[model samples]
Target: MTQLDTAPARLSPAEPSVAEPPAASAVARLTTASPLGRIVVEGDGSAITRLEIERAGALSTDGLPDAPDDLTRRAVDQLGEYFSGSRHDIDVPVRLTGTPFQRAIWEGLRAIPFGATRSYGELGRDTGRATAGRAVGGAVGANPVPLIVPCHRVLASDQRITGYSAGDGVPTKVWLLDHEGIAHR
Candidate 1:
C-alpha cells in the first residue's frame, strides 16, 4: 500500500477562508519527462495544486516559474522513484480544489491499495454515493493529480479499461496498470 498523509481528505467549510489567498508569485511549476510522457506539475509553495500529463501537444506552462520550488522538486523526485519501481506510493501534500463530491471520490481513489483495482461502482459506493457511478467516473477524470492520486486504478465493472484522460489515454492507463501489476483487459 502507498503511504499517504493523514490529513483530512474533506476540507472544512471554514478552512478555505482561514488561509490567506496565495499571491500570483506563489505559483511554482516544473515539467519533467516520465515513462508515461512529459508531465507538468504546479504547486502553491506548500502543496501541489495540479499535475498534467502531456499528450499530443505539450501542456502550457505560461507565466509559471522557470525553476521548480522545493516542493515541486521533491514531487518530481518521487515521480522518478515511482517510474523506476522503487516507490509504490507518492507521499506529497496536495491541495485538491473541487466540489465536495469530487473531493470525496478523489479520497476514495487514494484509498485503493497499490496494484489493486476498483470498479467505478465500487468507488462510488466507497465514497457514499453508491448509485452515482457516472458521477464518480466524472470526478475521477477531473482529478488533477493522476498518478499521485492513482486514478488509473479504477476500471469498469468487468475490470476492463474504460478510458483515461491523461497522457495517451487508455494506453497511458495500461502502462501504469502494467507497471503496478494490475490485471485488466
Candidate 2:
C-alpha cells in the first residue's frame, strides 16, 4: 500500500484552536457528495476545522457560508481522490481543538500507515498512555476530521469492530477499513 499523509500541524495551546476561532473570523462550509455519502467540511478560510459524513439524514447548511476556500477545496478534492483509489493520503492543513491528550491520540492515529490498523491498547501505548485505552477510545471517537485523520484505522485488541462515530457508525468504519484492505472481524 502507498504511504498515507501524516496529520497536519497542531496548534499550540496559546494559539486559537479551530473550535474557538477569533470572534470575527468567518466559518466557511462546503458539502460534497462522495461514495460514502454527503461530506460536509467547515473551515475558517485558512484551515479545516470539521468534517461530517451524512447518511440516512438530510444535509444541513445551518446558515453557514458555502463558498469553498482554497484549503477546504483542496481537502475535498483529496478526499475524492482517496475514495477513487488514486490517492492514499490527504495532505491538507487542519486545525484541531481538543485536550492535549486527545491531540496526542489524534496524532498517533495519523501515524498508522495506510492499509494498516492498531488496537486501542496499542494506540494508547504508542501515544505514551499505555493504561488509557478508554480515554484513547474517547479521543478517537471525538476526532473531528475522521478520514483525514484516519481514525478508522483503530480497532479492538482482538481486531473486532468496536464502533465509529461518523456516517453509519460501524458500517462506515467497516467500509473504510475494507477500502484500505484492512482486516477486521
Residue lDDT tens for model 1, 1-185:
12122232222222222234356556788999998778988878777778999887667674455568998898899999999999888877777777777777788887777899889999888767899978998999999888878899999989899999998899999999999999999
Q: Candidate 2's residue-wise lDDT over 57-92, tens digit each?
A: 655664455877887888889889999999887877
Supply candidate 1's per-residue lDDT for 170: 97
| Ten contiguous residues with the weakest lDDT in model 2 | 1-10
Off by over 4 Å in 1: 1-25, 62-65
The parts of candidate 2 lying over 4 Å away from their true place are 1-24, 60-65
Question: What are the models' TM-scores?
Answer: 0.86, 0.85
- What local lDDT score does residue 128 receive in model 2, on the 0 to 100 scale? 88
Candidate 1: the clashing residue pairs are none
Best TM-score goes to which candidate? Answer: 1
- State the C-alpha lDDT per candidate: 0.79, 0.79
